[model samples]
Target: MTVSENDTRSPLLTVRDLAVDFRTTDGIVHAVEGVDIEVYPGETVAIVGESGSGKSTTAMAVIGLLAKGGTVANGSISFDGRELVGLSENELRKVRGNQIGMVPQDPMSNLNPVAKIGTQIAETLLAHGQATRHNVNEKVVETLTAAGLPDAERRAKQYPHEFSGGMRQRALIAIGLACRPRLLIADEPTSALDVTVQRTILDQIATMTQEIGTSVLLITHDLGLAAERAARVVVMHRGRVVEQGPAQQILNDPQHPYTQALVKAAPSVAAARLQPQVFATERGVADGSDGSGGSDGFAGSDGSGGSATAKPIDNIVEIEGLTKVYPKRGSKEDFYAVKDVSLSIPRGETVAIVGESGSGKTTTARMLLKVIEPTAGVMRFDGQDVAHLKGKELRSFRQKVQPIFQDPYSSLNPMFTIERIIAEPLEFYKRGNSAQRRAKVRELMESVALPNSMLHRYPSELSGGQRQRVAIARALALDPELIVCDEPVSALDVLVQDQILTLLSDLQRERGLSYLFISHDLAVVRLISDYVCVMKDGELVEAASSEEIFTNPRDPYTRRLLASIPGNELKIAS
Candidate 1:
């Protein structure tokens, strides 16, 4: 599927010297300028970049779906020999679902919460004239089945709330492909899902689109994903196309500095750097460059981006036979969310627990944080039984342990300034006087690499990464010995995620911090963990050093997780 520069077929989508502008409150902002791309029938092309790099904006301009205050300032968007730049709303509506389709990023935000899944898909089918009212029900099920959802008929009747994140994503894919359009634009389609689910959804897209001979324009921040899925990769940076070439070519030897940084920052490529022998020999993964200018895999950031942490000599926290059981309704058997799980976090090191959704990883973290009481277990922190702590001891334990949550947008208070957000804990604990607390807040901000100028800015004024930095600063305000990091970098792009990981690692070394890291992303787990714990179905199935786990995994499930990593099969050696 490698499409060369001289690809002969007339592109299904072509943008020639496109320029886009937005009317911001401050002034007119040029979002995209002089950008060009093509998508041939049945070919896949990716637009990869950071959040504000104009990748998504370029895609939106193609479908005439620009946000308010945005418009195409110049150039032409030719789709199947028809120009779409100046089309009216009515004209564009006719062309949208019938000729082109889009699957946006967040499924929860896109799906209609008040409507049934079938009704939503039916609306698209009816609008596109793909099905009549009498046969629309049957068509809906067919579409869902094609999108790889099992029991489509029953699933169709459920609301969006009833479906899991992966299931909801499948429904979006079904709706996007229902019209069988000539082009499909998937924007960050699998950014939030687990590796296994992400692979399933992408596979379904590839199969369904190839069957229909539909072209794909994938928008994502993951270079490894683009390398694995798309035939060509278009690297964007600061509202411009920095480079364009074959997927493997860009992945192996990127020309642009930003592109090289992205490759090195990717989890799949970085994790591969840990122990290339495991993947190169036993798993059929060939030796390849990690885009860090090294023959062997080396994800550059001080030459140890994904290497295992040094072993620590002390246990900061330990658990014995942890279990949590919830009673079912109407005499059904009690459900076990976490059962007999035992693990320990070494002092001044990171321990990662990885599993898919409903795998009890989060449940176990909650128990460790004392957010939820375990049914039967002995939890010890600093050699004290945490379950028996009450009054001042419990409050002191709370001060010593803190949580850095998943979503940066929700973790901080929008109404408060960054200074207040960071200073709240210090104020609550009565750590110092007003002036001292403010100084402490500034110190925490500086520790997390935030500027002093942004002290008075609200959370809404900051980007996702900035807000996450603020979250870390808040967590560090209490000077906790242990931090329960629940997917702290899951929502961030590669570059920002790399910064956060680096910050965490530095903090651990400086302050002797212990991290109980929980995530479904094995790649990130590989990058930041000293010991790896593999969980499934409420049980701890495998536990070992990060180096041993990634290289020579003994458990089949662990091997499967490694195999599903994006770009796991790509040979970037040359």
Candidate 2:
């Protein structure tokens, strides 16, 4: 994936003075205003911003995917000299998925759950007349294989539920690239994937586009990813273009205030956790506590200065020889999701488990939460074995340990308001009367940095970050000593991720909270964790203090995981 000198060629896609609006009950909401962008042939350009910044809305308008009540009030979208703003539905049909292919953010929502993977790809091919009825199957297989899925035939027969998150994303990529369109719009294509899978999927996209001389308009909130993959970067904020320049320049020496805030907030660019001085200096400036700058509260010192050499305190949770095995449907042998995992978390400290998908991280977390019974081994919580606790003891244990899930959208209930969601735990525990519960809910909301006025709103009205904050607030309603945060910030954009990480750090400092953090993002692990545990193939490959793991990793797998972070290979401007 090399950057091409496509400036000599005419632009493949151009948007000039674009403005979009949506009619709502309140009034007309302007989503995009006077936004300008261009993508040259065979070049990759990225549009990056926080959620509701209008980047995704602009892309949707260009691809004719605006939802009902949304309209392109004013703008000129031209692809290959064809104006797209005023095109009819039939005319746009011929252009969409044929001339301009789109890979949406969420695979499960976009994909047909009832259809086979191959059939879906085949439908896309047949709809665009890219393949004849006879060779459609062959084309589907070829496309899947090209997108890096192994044993394409077997995978094609499986439904979406049978596929892992990474595999499902690959199928979507295959569908997007099946026709080899002249331009591709990938909207946060790998936001839900692990780092390793994200690298592979991105590499596949770059290779395919470079081979076909196709232009790419990448939409993401990850600045490191934008710097690593794109030739040019466009920064959007509040429905306006704030900055546009070469990717490295914008990352290294961003002139715009918002762009500078984004660079400072990106954890991937921060120093490793082991070096206290370096970490303090870099993080202090980013967080605006160094006395040298004052900006959005996106970055702040985590105060983990002496955690590397700090002595272990009292044990909050301890696991020994923990294992989980499931019977194979058609075989006598068992499948082990977790095997002989041993680790301990100290009181008021965070221990992070980092690994790729299907590597037993989530399984280990589930076992700790007692969501599933471990097939073998013992789990001790504050000095008592909890593996077989029942009745009152189990209920007591539940109050001490809570969980924050990965997908905020699915974890929350649509029928419930924010107030009800937070108050349910209090009601379940019979903690207090109606007035007391309401007061507690408002306190929880304040602790999570959300306004109490939103108490009556449902989850659908909030953004991804806000929804996740609500989830956190609900988890904290029980005042749990140890929270099992499973990929809590992976789906968020860089700025929102920074805010959440900072919020967690602040809470830990103030409340003396302990966390069993499980995530695939090493950079984030470095920011908030005191100890690090690396897992592979359901086994603990390495376990050490956070400093030792980041600075002196002994295991090959650990080193590989560190090296796979995005933008690590590139020479980012200082």
Query: Would you give me the overall lDDT of model 1?
Result: 0.85
Q: Per model, how many backbone clashes are there?
A: 0, 2
Record all residue pairs in model 2 with backbone atoms less than 3 Å apart, i.e. clashing: 287-299, 287-300
Q: How accurate is candidate 2 locally (lDDT)?
A: 0.85
Q: Model 2: how far is 69 from its true place, Å?
A: 1.7
> Which tens-of-lDDT digit does each residue in 453-561 have in candidate 2?
9999999999989999999999999999999999999888788888888888788877878899999999889888877788998988877667666766778998888
Q: How far in Å is the alpha carbon of 307 misplaced in model 2?
A: 17
Error of 2 at 364 (Å): 1.4
RMSD of each: 6.8, 6.9
TM-scores of all candidate predictions against the true structure? 0.92, 0.89
Top model number, lDDT: 1
